[model samples]
Target: MDFKGLWTTIKKNAIHLFKKARKAIKRYIRKLVKHTKAGDYSVLIYTIFALVALILIIVMFANIFSLGGKKKSTLDITTTEVATPADVTEDPQIAAQMALKQQAMDIYSRNKDFIFLVDENHPLAEGYSFEHHTLNCGLDIDKRIYNDFSEMLNACNMAGYEYNIINAYIDKATQTELYNSAVAHYVDQGLLEEEAQAQVGKSVDKPGCSEHETGLAIDLTDVEVLGEEDYKSTRGTDQWLMNNCHKYGFINRYPANKVSVTGVSDEQWQFRYVGREAAEFMAANNLSLEEFMELVQ
Candidate 1:
């Protein structure tokens, strides 16, 4: 398909994401409503938080789908109606999704012309919640995680394998550099600049949108840090790390099997620190970080 057709497909998929979020939120509220109906004074705060969460979802999706400057009447109406917390309970699903358009752009990176930019205003800031940790591999991760991660590294070393921290905790500027470089590469391959930018979006998340900014995500290798070519070629498998990393609180952030939900290609070397408890749960259930997050939080 052409760009427009490809974009339409992307948008359609993005809409599915919004729907998924809407349903999940609705399910959460259903459990809380009983306490709310009984007027449990303490539950009021949770109610407010849920409403705020709904608003964040709406606003984020609105920016993603409507970035092209097209006047989306559905979102406009939905935003208008849900003016306050009171409106969320009135029509949970509609209020939840009134803002997300019928598109998926695979939140990997939005496909819409307007959504090409990252929603810097979205609830999660790149690594805003994680503390910094300096690892001996010459890379820094979220603080306090060094112990668990180091144990994983040490296990690899003991196995007569060496590991390299390919990248960890990139800042927005570095993300911009990677993004621009990817776009340039695509352009060199003969794609139009705009298409190249979108293609870049598919892989290199917008500067402020990358999870690596949080220091919880890391790209590693079993051999010396080589260029992507070398990294790919020398990507020796340290089964000790893969099978046992989750025991220490990391998971393959984007596994090949979950590409449909993650919207990114599999990177066996990429891992994210979700904590041991959550990691175990995720691994046990065969869930991706995205799915686990949707369910638990």
Candidate 2:
């Protein structure tokens, strides 16, 4: 009977409820603002990111400068390599006489055929004559072969080993005479004169190159003082020469196994001075001068 009035009352109540709901939402919004103002986590997150980026930048800059410093150091060290023999020979700074004199003497002596003058006038004629004057039986190498072969001789006297210089420098004339004589001997033994001469190194420098002409090469003889039984076979002062000679720039040039490479026999008595570093390098590697030259190339 009063349904319309009841509907109007319900509508009024619903409007009041909507107002209350809106006020309640506004209060919660205010509360959220207050909590955010107290402390915002967003600032902390941004600070952390910034700090990480700063650290990365510093690390990168440090790496770049470190690499640059190393590059500069490496460049400085790459500048110096030792000069080779050919380089020294060709350099205008080095005097030609220094290079040519040794070669000239070597060539002249070879052409004259290794006739070493034992007389006073010869360059190598006079020096100290030791009490012991021979080594390795008939091997007549010079006194200069050892580092201080003379000093070694003195030591030998102290050690009771008889050291000697059976032969020293053979001049060009002497070499030629020796060659001719060897040739004659070969002919008498039934070989042709030219063939016999060819067997021995010629003073002309056409066939056999004389290592002796270098003045660095030498042969030894009569090493034993009292005609000792093991003179040739036993280890004598020459063993000291073989083991320590490289320190003084000499090598057992014609080593036993290297005969085929050197075109000469295993000359236990022969030694050649190529200088310490070169000799050590050669002997250590078992290389001949020709082989070493190739390696240098």
Candidate 3:
């Protein structure tokens, strides 16, 4: 029965029991008075005991009904089901997307320490150092990622793409010099030192802020396109590298479209190692390092 109907029934039964109890008490009182008047003290004692037992029975029934009602109410509340967004059957496309994201997260969790951010806004900590392996081309990269980098270069060679490593793993002093030189070039054009620095900042990251300081960034160029005025052009080897770098745990650190977000102009040759899974995730989503960091967080 519904809670309200059951409660009504219990109330009616309780009222009937109370009425009967009251009638019995009244009868006992009358008997007690009669027995006292007749000088029968034993009958008076028996009537008093009977009245006490009847009251105890009434109290026990009241407690049982009260407890029953409470338990019913509690059961109704506890067993009630509430629908939510998560309960719906997931779409196949969405499920596949979620699986990919979970896979990326698993990869990220295993390599989060190595997949760090270093940009104009996020500088490397002072005294930062890493075990590094120098490539046969004389460029050094973080030792932990050497195998992946080597594999990538081997793949590029096998694909018949001719390229040269222009820069990698710059020390703070060298980065400072590069920064100063860029600023000097702008200053020679009659811009004030501060203005020149501001202009240069868009292209050259200031000293400690450079990703090369972490030994995980590399700059490359097609052998034919190395001396071009527009180094940002993705011709020949640059095109191949940009298209396939993610497969080997590298990302084009600065894409032309993400200039505003990265706070640096695009260098099509610039690539950074962020591990295979992260690179693939970023590539798939068209995310820069800054954007990827925000997304995972």
Worst 10 residues of 1 by lDDT: 108-117
Which residue pairs in candidate 3 have backbone atoms (N, alpha carbon, C) closer than 3 angstroms, thus clashing? none
Off by over 4 Å in 2: 1-53, 58-160, 199-208, 225-233
Off by over 4 Å in 3: 1-104, 188-190, 228-232
lDDT of 2 at 203: 27
**Which lDDT value does model 3 have at 275?**
87
Please provide, for model 2 over 255-278, each residue's C-alpha lDDT reduced to its tens digit, 9 standing for 90 to 100: 667766655454556666565556
TM-score, predicted candidate 1 vs. hidden true structure: 0.53
Q: Which prediction has the highest lDDT against the true structure?
A: 3
Model 3's TM-score against the true structure: 0.64
Where does model 1 exceed 4 Å of error?
1-123, 126-130, 187-191, 224-236
The true-versus-predicted C-alpha distance at residue 201 of model 3, in Å, is: 2.0
RMSD of each: 26.3, 24.0, 14.8
State the RMSD for candidate 2: 24.0
lDDT-best of 1 and 3: 3
TM-score of each: 0.53, 0.49, 0.64
Ten-residue stretch with the least lDDT total in model 2: 113-122
lDDT of 1 at 141: 80
